[model samples]
Target: MSDSRGAAMSDGRTATKGLAFHRLSAPSVLALARGEGGGAAVEELLTAERSRRLLLVRALADSLGEGDPPHPAGTAPMAHRAAWTLLARTQQRAPRVFENILMSPQTGMWLSLALRRLRGATAYEDAPLWVVAGHLSALAAAVGARAGLDFSLTVPVRHGRVPLPTLGCAVFADAAEPWGTAQVDAREGRLRITAGRETVTAGPEWSRSAPGWHAVRRLELEPTGPGKVLLLDELDPYRTFPHPSPPRLLSADEARTWQELLTGAWEILRRDEPQSTEAMRVGLMSLAPTPARERYRPHSVTAGDAFGGVMASRPDDVAQLAATLVHEFQHTKLGGLIHLGPLSEPSAPPGAPEQLFYAPWRDDPRPLGGLLQGIYAFAGVARFWSVHRHAADAAYAPMAHFEFALWRAQVSSTVDLVHRHDRLTALGRRLLGTLRERCEEWMAEPVPPAELALAQEVAADHRARWRAHHLRPPAAAVQDAVEAWRRGDARPPAALAAPPELAPVADTRYLDTAAVLARYRLGAPAADPSDIEGVTAADLLLARGDLSGAREAFVTQLAGKETASDAWAGLGRALAGATEHRDASRLLRHHPERARAVQSALEHATGRGADPVELATWLGLGPGETDLD
Candidate 1:
């Protein structure tokens, strides 16, 4: 390696531009934060991220010397074939601060998983293999090396923290084993790692011993079913990290409840989807309780690709557990697929936040990849429920059936848009084909006519809202049309294009039970003032032909101190329904949702729809409807 480095230096082919990595003084960084408490934390995070990235730079320089990616092997063994694929194609450039290693989205997740799997599979038993989790330590290290920040496996865990992997986190470790153990004493806020002949502990400057090492208590996984099942409580992420809000530890009775849920869900998966069960057994190994605030969500998340551990809030709905498992495991699976090959090529630009499609599952507009993930996840969920729904009780069965039909149609339509996309590689195309097959099979499954109608309405309402938000006619054209209509001119303008609308200000898109069965099953979990569920409910009310109820709900939701965008959009539809089709351009022309409502209301007002003059008076758009005559 030294000879190679010397040779590269001689030939001027070395990656070492030898730029010194600058470290920002803590005091200086804090001073820049202006004494604002949260700002200080932000500064600290930035410092840590920068410092860790510098370490990666050092590591990369040491590893590669000068050769291109897929260069000669080093100290530790790696799943080099798949792991190095991205490296070979990676564009080389001078290492700069604040720049992330070139990776597709979630590539970090896969690298961590690959390391974990590699560590588990290797037979060397001399020393315990360390699983490096946190993205800062693992991903940055992997990608940095790819970019020529060449160093060996072991990395610095910033702030004197142990590189303990997060639950269900993807992790990394050196191919070569460290000479000694790193003893961590969280109770005393101390870390001692002895790699080779070097031994170091945290100094005073290092705070809290490690990045997230807060717990003095060891979270033991108590084996239930005499080692077949595990009941875990202490593994909560809050316990590990300095959390703003830590969840209260579950009592023995609470653990019992969790155990029951896990056992039941496992049974369902083990029977219905054996592959999912096996994948989960291999990937998802530990469970951590989440804070209450996370309830009504998907109920679970893995830190990265390290599937051996997961954190989730206890669920009110047991059926949701299996569904969550399937959903998250798909992410893990996708991560592996990513490591294996590029699903999406390097060409067409990734979708920006505004251009993303609004998925039914999330309040925010998701990038195309995110939408693809959503549809793929749902496909798995649909498959699970397709077989399992029949065995469920009355309320659960209908909800499951609704879920199956919804995802079936949603995935089908979504695939059509993505199928011919230039970004998809051959492997990506093949995956989509399989998903389409599953969708077809599930779409054929029987759903009650009424349930199906309800599902369709929810689907249509969201799509229409998305369309109204994103897909718009040109503003000039719309203005021309409006003016022409005002002038009693017949011809309409050509087109209006609008940017896609994401949900307003952090809406909690709770994973609620199917709206069709919510009344009989899960009750309304309160959402913040900005959530779109109210608007969704209002739409459902309209679909039921309960015009007054829909009006009242929309108005009530809109009555918030600030009118949410969704509420305004629903109000437009509600006003149109209530007035029997008129004008809702009364207020909110500044926003697109409201403008569309106005247009929709006005468009339907004429031709046996409603008395335009009366609607104008009722809606307060004007003394009377636009005088188009």
Candidate 2:
């Protein structure tokens, strides 16, 4: 066991030696990243180069203050072997540089000279590069000593709210039960670490204490022997730390609803594997600990998983809670399959948001901005698909069919984009295609004859209810889009052709921003091909006192899709008292024809001898339409 002063001297020597190794590793990595020379580049070059530098640094640090040239005994032998393997691999890959620089002692001398030159300068040449090198050297020393890998593991420890990478000397030390520790003191604007048992206490950094939980910064870890300890350290002022705030405690009835939600979802998971499912449930219960825990907070689920794992946050309210759990749980499953490696790697591309794969059950209206809302819609589609696969037959009740259709249509449109689709490899693409085929089968296949009749009856009831419900303009747009599809006109399916005229300002200004409200027709819950919104040519025709022209516009709009319900309604009204009354009657009877307001307006206009002024009054037409002159 070395004393603190002796250890510091040895650490200094190790740092000097490691820096020499780093200099040699740096230029090659720089050259490679810059593409200075070789055309025979492999994709793994960066990783390989990094591994090589780390290995060589480990070697020099390990070799220092050692017995023999070859180094002796235990983990050192393993470290030597690993370094040798890396050297051999590097030589084989880039022999010219390996021979000229890495294999020669002269290269070390050259690097040392370069370091002396930099040391004399007023300004640092490359801060992060040097910092990473110094920190990594210290880190490797500590980690090597602790892990017995002869390599560093540097974890940033907080000091008075500032974190600094502390150099661990064990990364270079050769002894039984090697250990390393580094102290960081931000209040003094410096770091101090003492080896062995030495009491060094610093002041507090940050604190967060609630009723049942406490989070204190300045976590400290004292090395017992080899492994590291978990201790509080100083917290940062500039860095924002989000603490979980407690929610209102659930009442008995609310708790019961949560329980039912959890139970129902668990039944599905239990069907797959009961033991594992129960284990997860137990784990989740442990994380929350009590009913007042905030569920939506970050790391709440992760923290819970550490204990046992909870299936849902509290599990209150069967429909809402189960929907939420199923959505997130689907992510856990499909994310693994798609991520194809570690959970750290995202299932989708770099820019993709988490919500893209995990839609929430609480159906809050989207964030105010329509573009932001649109972005969420994109993610919602993927989330819905993941949740949909686990949904029960009866689960399709209460807008379930609509939800499924929304997800389906999004997948179709998104897969058509080359960038998004190209991210899918051939096999992934094939798998997605197969999934689509399966979905189509489910949607188109007739239920058994008994169920078929029952489904038709249900569909009829649903239609009547839907019609009886006040059709908000967006809802009418969705219905019109659906009817347009039935009539064989579906284009741009739920896409805005151009950014709307007042898109930027109006989108954010009004509570009921026309663009965002209209966006719902083209998004999740009503992603039908015909669900177009935003003012169109039909509005123009109806304004011009040209019912004949408006009817033509309605026919054109419905020719490809039933996107505009307002347009459809206008057309119906225009023809109601005309020579084309028969044609108008047929259109008025069409599914999702006109709103009650529009229908009333049509009756009034017909009774008033097709007067434009009277029709405009009934239709809630603006001053622009009435030609007030």
Candidate 3:
């Protein structure tokens, strides 16, 4: 935790040589692979991340070489050098306070972004140079305030707001400029900021009424016996991933709601998953709330460089909130581990054809790295639901059980595919093997028959939908099938049996309709399906276990001008449920893209539609079969 631990040598080598050669014990690695790292392991990760951030900060400074500035007054090089000098002085006087500012999640994010911008790896349109380098000045201001130091520095003001990295933001009401700099003078724990002719001042304690300063809110929760604090950060420009954004501060009511939801979620995790609770208490530092998206489907993300930070939309309930924490923390842990060593070979060469694979949780195909992350994340999710199901009430239990059943299978199958990949290194193979063992252990656990069936149906439906959305059959094969049907041939051409290749489509909407409907059914069995946004009547019938009704509904829809991929996948689900029309069901489920392509080609050629089931039956039958019946 000392400043020297992360100090860079003259040649830019990290002084902390142990970090370069760090290795986790076998037991610790196994626990992490199973999504159960204790506090000690997390502490190691946090320390490593802190060192990485320090290295990045040094690199950022180096990138701005010590050369004469084109605009010597108030340029990035000048500001960066001034900030560095102030930080070194502050570290000498108040080491702990300096460390706190250095380790702030916003500091890490800013370091990565500023370095990228300096190195020309990213573009920032019309952004003033001070906007990137001024972060160091903001960090210095925060440290000075905390350490009761006397200092004055000019920091960037973006969109009329001056944000002190970890402390809070100062708003300028009279300032109309889009980008400028504010001079902050701090002495004896008091802060005064002046921009142009306007000025604002605040005492040691922040206050909304203290002229124009907004305090960074912190949430304190006692989930277990000990208290834990997390910053409800909405004012940090670096809170978002990849780049800086304008602050989206929460309202009073919204902030209170977030506090309540986080409290309940922490309590649930404390009661059910104490090990995970410990890991989070040590490593999960801040939560940045994004605008809410689709209901019951909260989006969450963790950046590789921003360790201990999570950016998530509001959740539907406490259980979901807790699960989101678990899911994102898994990503946080894996990101740290990958930074320590190689997991897979350097990413596939650009335009590599075999790079992308099926990811059960996403709408589009994922590359190998994304697939690995998803596998680890959903494995944690499956583990969460596996235990949460036992604690859930009757109304919620089905959904919990279904989630566990579905993800266990998905993670296991994905692990099987990744294990055989040629790119995994020795350490990567070891980690994957440990993860596979945990998945195998979970796979043996029994679920209720009905919930298990629903889980299987949802999985199959997603795969079929993904296929229909992303894969395209060979054009020659499709044309041959169309021609044979036009000639009134008894069977499809043998060429139609060729496997499909990926020609991804752009329409990804409604791909998760089946899963969404399943969740709704499990939560409120009698809920009206027509009220749902993406759920169709046929989907409702299938969700309710009315196979015959769903089959007829889908058939009627297909008989018309409807060419939606969901209809084809829906018919496949209904037929699979009925256990009749096996040939047609198999074709629709496995080669949905092929079947749809041939059907579209035939319709385009003759200016007339054909029977959906009959077309599938014909294509699915062996080449030797002579009769459509």
Q: Which is the leading candidate under lDDT?
A: 3
Candidate 1 lDDT? 0.44
Off by over 4 Å in 2: 1-253, 268-320, 334-420, 425-431, 447-629
Could you give the candidate ranking by lDDT, starting with the highest? Answer: 3, 1, 2
lDDT of 3 by residue, 156-257 (tens): 888889888667888988888788788889887898999988888876885343668888888897845689999888988888776667778899899999
- Which ranges in model 1 have alpha carbons more than 4 Å from their true place? 1-249, 293-296, 349-355, 468-472, 488-545, 552-563, 568-594, 597-629
What is the C-alpha lDDT profile of model 2 across 25-94, one tens digit per residue?
3332222222121212221222223334334444444543243122222433343344344444444555
The TM-score measured for candidate 2 stands at: 0.29
- Report lDDT (CA) for all predictions: 0.44, 0.30, 0.80
Worst 10 residues of 3 by lDDT: 1-10
Using all chains and alpha carbons, the TM-scores for the candidates as numbered come to 0.56, 0.29, 0.92
Candidate 3 backbone collisions, by pair:
none
Note each model's CA RMSD in angstroms: 16.5, 20.1, 3.8
- How much RMSD separates candidate 2 from the native structure? 20.1
Better of 2 and 3 by TM-score: 3
lDDT: which is higher, 1 or 2?
A: 1
Error of 1 at 173 (Å): 31
For candidate 2, what is the lDDT? 0.30
lDDT of 1 by residue, 1-629 (tens): 01111111021233456533233344432321211112232333333333333343334433433322221134222322223332333323433311333221122233433243333544212222222222233333334333433332333232222332221111114315323223222123333344434444432223222332332222322234323333253422222211212224466677667777777777777677765665555444455565444334445665423323455677756677887777665654454334334455654454533345557766456766677667666667766777777877875677777666676677777876676666677656766766666566667777888668667755654554454454444545555545545665433333322332344434433223234333232233243322334436765575456767876776665544443444544454455533444444232222334245335434544322123223223333332224311
